[model samples]
Target: MSVKIRLQRHGKKQKPFYWIVAADARSKRDGKYLEKLGTYNPNTNPATIDLNLDQAVQWLHNGAQPTDTAKAILSYKGALLKHHLDGGVRKGALTQEQADAKLAKWLEEKAGKVDTKKEGLSKAQEVAKAKALKAEKEANDKRAAAAVEAAKVEEEVAVEETPEVAAEETPEVVAEVAVEETPEVALEETVAEVAPEETPAAEETSEETEA
Candidate 1:
């Protein structure tokens, strides 16, 4: 019975999650498995993995052939490296203690790199959010200033229109003044006629006296 180490697909569409399994080679892709290794979640930033390193190495040592993608996953998580080191221990080329120390150091370095990437991503998001907020605030302030300027312009237009409206209304007032002075003009004409009559009467009286 040939056993294979592979990933079984799960999770929703587009967002894929997988289970690492040791299963019979003849079984369907989603069928029964011999042993469950762990899980792999690629939706995360660094691609979260929860692998049992000892179990993976054991399966590899037992000749369970891994699929191409699973091989890469195992290689990335240090399972392949541990298996190789164990091989060296079996061949008397290196001690178990030396292999353990090297694996430990490599894992520590990988973890540090993951942490650095996470911190950089977080800082970049914060900067972008702050910049967007500043831009929005500036837009709002510009709109408010434009509205105030428009109001001032409208007020000035109303002030300019007031005098024009009053000028239009003044012609009737001038006509009324002209009509009120007509009676005084008529009285002056009557006085002029009486003066002429008095002049003629004076001339007649002088002649009678002389006679």
Candidate 2:
């Protein structure tokens, strides 16, 4: 029976996630598989891949032909490199101990690279968040300043209206005071005129009696 390495679709539509499997060549795409080697999820920021390195390399050594996508996945996880080292050991070009040392060193270097990439991504996300916060603060400040300006203009308009209202009331108050004073002056003049007429009549009567 021919063996093959391929992806088995598992997640929902438009959000695809897969399982790496070693199966019989005649099996359907998502049908029963001989062995599950790993998982792949592309929903994450840098995509997530998890593989059983020993099992995958063993399958490769057992003559399992991997599909193009599965091959790339295996390469990324260093399964292909490990297989190459094992082949070199079998061919007597290198000892098993030397191959193990080389693989350990390579895995260490790859880990350091992954750590650096994660750090860079974290820093970028922080910067983007800070920028968004700053923009929101600036927008809030602008709105506050505009509200203050509008209030000040309304206050000024009210102040101006109050003086105009006072000016209009002043003329009415002055006219009322003038009307009250005119009535008192007219009464005084009438009393003076009556007293002069009475004095003249008394003088005339006395003059006639003396004659």
The models' CA-based lDDT, in order, is 0.95, 0.95
Per-residue lDDT of model 2, residues 34-125, tens digit only? 99999999898677999999999999999999999999999888899999999999999999999999999998998898889989999999
Residue 128 deviation, candidate 2, in Å?
1.0
Q: Every model's Cα RMSD, please?
A: 7.0, 6.5
Question: Number of backbone collisions per candidate, in order?
Answer: 0, 0
Q: Estimate candidate 1's RMSD in Å.
A: 7.0
Clashing pairs in 2: none
Segments of candidate 1 deviating more than 4 angstroms:
166-211
Q: By lDDT, who's the top model here?
A: 2
Give model 1's clash tally.
0
Best by TM-score: 2
lDDT score for candidate 2 against the true structure: 0.95
